[model samples]
Target: MEGAVISDEQVDLLLADTLEQYGYDFTGYSRASLKRRILRLFTLDKALSFAEFRYRINNDSSYFKRFVEQITVNVTEMFRDPMFFKTLREEVLPKLGTYPFIRVWVAGCSTGEEAYSIAIILKELNLLEKSLIYATDINPAVLDRAAQSIFALSYMKQYSENYILSGGTKEFSGYYTANYSLAKFNDDLKKKIIFSTHNLVSDRSFNEFQLILCRNVLIYFDRELQHKVFGLFDDSLEELGYLALGTKETINFSPFLKKYKRLGTEKIWRKIQK
Candidate 1:
C-alpha cells in the first residue's frame, strides 16, 4: 500500500474506460504525461485500491469530473512569457485591428488568464467593442472559476510585472479591485469574453478565428494527436490568421508546414496559404 504502482495495462484500461464512460478521449495524449498525472492523482486522493479508484471514476459523476480536472494540465498565469505578449501587442494585434470584427479563440485556456490578457489588450487598442473572445477548456470546473473573473490577490505583483514587460504602460492594478484574498477584475474586461467547455481531443472546430492561442497545451499530446489538433486549428483559422503556441512548440515537420510562415523567433505562425 505504501508504493502502489499502476501497470501499463491498467493505464490502458483506465483510458478506455474513461472514453467509454465519459466520452473523453485521452487515448491520443502522451502516455508518460498521462500516466504520471494519473498516478499523482491516485496518490493525492489516497485511493484504497486501484479497483476502487477505477470504479469511482467510472461511476461517480462528480469524482469523474475531479479526475478529469486533476489529470489535464491547468497551470497558467497572466502575461506568461512576457516577450510573447509583447509581440502580440506590437506586431499581431495591430494587423488584426484592421479587420472590421475580430474573433479570437483561446483553446485550452485553463482558468482564462490568457483570455483576460487578450481582452485587456483589445480594450487598450480600442478594439474591444468589436471583438469577441472565445475562451475554452476541457474541464467545466475551471471554466466556472474563469467566468468569475476573480484570481488570487497574491499573484497580482508578478502578473503586474509581466504586464509591464509586455509593454503595458498603465497601472496593471487598475484592471482589478482587491477584495481581501481575491482580486476581482473589472466587468468591462470580461464583457467581450465567452467561457465554455471545449475538448481539443474530440471536439470539432466551431468557428473561424483571426487569432488562436493554444500555448503550453500541445506538448502533452502525442505526435499523432498534435497533427490532428494542427489540422483542427487550420480549419478553424481564417486566411492570413495567426496561430500562437508555447515557447517549446512549433509547426515544423507537420503537414501544415507549407501553409504557415513563422513570425520571427516567437512561436507564432501566420497562415499564408489556403
Candidate 2:
C-alpha cells in the first residue's frame, strides 16, 4: 500500500510557519491553492515529512531555493497564446514604436521563453536595437537559466508552431542551433535583453515602462496583492503605454478598469488617455 498523504491543516502550518520564519509573505496567497501546491511538494519530496520539510526550508538556503521552485513552477512557451503576440504586433507595437526609444518590462519572465518571444517580435518590427527589455523573475535559478538562452530540444517544435501562428515568416530553426540535447538561441537575439532576479513579492517599482507584460503571474497572488501589483504597473507605465496580462487575467475587476481599455481580444490593454 502507498503512504498516507499530509493534511491541509498541516500544510498550512508548514507554509504559515515557514513564512513567519523567513518573511516571504505567503499569507497573501490563495489558501486552497497554496495547500494544493504544498501537497504536491510533499509528494515530490517523499523522503521528507511535512515537519522535516518545514525544518529544512527554514534552516537551509538550498532547501528554500528548492521550495521556491516547487511553489512557483509555472508552464511557459515561446509565442504562447499567439493571439496575444498578434495583438501586440498589430495594436500595441505601433503605439510603442511611435516613441524614439522604448522600455519594456517582462515581469516574472520564467526561463526566458516570454522574453525571447518578445525579442523575436521586436526584431521583426525593426525595434530591437531601439528598445530595452528588462526581463525579471523572482527565482535566481530561473534567471541563471534564462541568461543561458538555451532551451530543451523537445520544446522547439511547439515554439516553432507558436511563432508561425503569431505571423512569423522565417524558419524557426534559423534562429537557433542544436547542441546535444539543447537548442542555443542566436547571440544577436540575446543581446537586447537583460535578465535579472526581481521579486515581485518584495521589490519596489524601479523604472517606468512603455510596455509591461506580466502574464499569468498574478494568478498566484491574492486579490489585494494583485491590486498592489496593478498599482505598481500603472505607475510604471507611461501615458498611453501598453499592458498585457495572462489569458484569464484582467484589469477589469481592479481600480485600473477605467484607466485602461483592451487593445484587442488578445489580453493586451492600453493606459487611459487622461
Candidate 3:
C-alpha cells in the first residue's frame, strides 16, 4: 500500500499509455476523481503498487473491465432528483409533443433507474408508444442489470416515494410487481428502451437524437472532457432539442453555454440554433 501512492506523473503516464494502447481515455477525466479510483485499486488489492497495478491492468482484460466499471461513476437511483422529473413532466414533455416520433438518448444511464424513471413519465404522458429510448453506459454490468429491469425489493419503498414526489399519476405500484426480493419492471416499459454499451470518452456518435440526458456522469470528468463530450451531445441532438443534466450540473461553464437555452434551474437545457 505504501508504494501505491498514485502521483500526478504516474497518473499522467498511466492515462496516456492507456489511451494510446487501449483507446480508453482517462487522461481527460478529473484529477481528483482519477486519484480516488486509482487509490482504491491499491487499497483494495494488496498485491499492487502504482506501477504494478498499471502493468497488471495493461495486460489483463478482466482487470481493465473492472477498472472501466469502477471509473464510470455508476451512482444513480430511481427518480433520484424529484425536481428534475417534475420539470420533465410539467415543462419538457408538453413541448416535445410536437414531434410525432421522439428518440431520447440517456447517456450514462446507471442500473436502469433513470431510464425507468423517464419511461414512467412518458407512459403517463401517453408518449411511450411514440418514443424510443436508447439508454447507454460504459459499465457493461450495470447495462446488463438495466436490461433485466429488475431491481432489489428493498429499494422500491424509497423509489415509490420518489415517484410520488415526481408527480406520479397512478399508484406507484402500478408500474412494477413484487416478487419476494426483486421488482421486475413492467414488460411494456422495458420494450420501449434499448440499453447498450456506449463510452462517452472513446466512442463515436451513433445517431442524432431528439433529446440527450447526460446527468451526473460528467461530474467525474475534467473540464476538457466535459467540453468534448458536450460537443458530442451538441452534434447528436436535433435542433432545439432538450439536454437534461444532473441537478448539480450545468452548461454555463462549457463552450455550449450560449448554444443552449437553460430552461430552468431544474437542470433542463434546450439546445438551440448554433
Which predicted model would earn the best lDDT?
Answer: 1
Candidate 2 residues 150-254, lDDT tens each?
Answer: 999999999999999998888999889999999999988899899987777667898989999999999888999899889889888987888999988988889
Alpha-carbon runs more than 4 Å astray in model 1:
none
| Candidate 1 similarity to native, TM-score | 0.99
Best by TM-score: 1
Candidate 2 ranges beyond 4 A from true positions:
1-4, 17-21
- Please provide, for model 1 over 1-274, each residue's C-alpha lDDT reduced to its tens digit, 9 standing for 90 to 100: 4687998899999999999988999999989989989999999899999999999999999999999999999999999999999999999999999999999999999999999999998988899999999999999999999999999999999999999999999999999999999999999999899999988989999999999999999999999999999999999999999999998998897999999999998999999998
At residue 214, candidate 3 shows an lDDT of: 92
lDDT of 3 by residue, 1-274 (tens): 6645668888788788778777887777788878888778667877545667888778887888777777667788999889889899889887887899989999999898999999999999999999999999878888988999899999989999999899986888888889999999999999999999888988888998888999998887888888899999998989889999876777889978887888867788897785
User: Which residue pairs show backbone clashes in model 2?
Assistant: none
Clashing residue pairs in candidate 3 (N, C-alpha, C atoms within 3 angstroms): 30-222
Q: TM-score of every model?
A: 0.99, 0.93, 0.94
Evaluate all candidate structures by whole-model CA lDDT and list the values in order: 0.95, 0.85, 0.86
Alpha-carbon runs more than 4 Å astray in model 3: 2-4
For the record, the alpha-carbon RMSD of candidate 2 to the native fold, in angstroms, is 1.9
Worst 10 residues of 3 by lDDT: 41-50
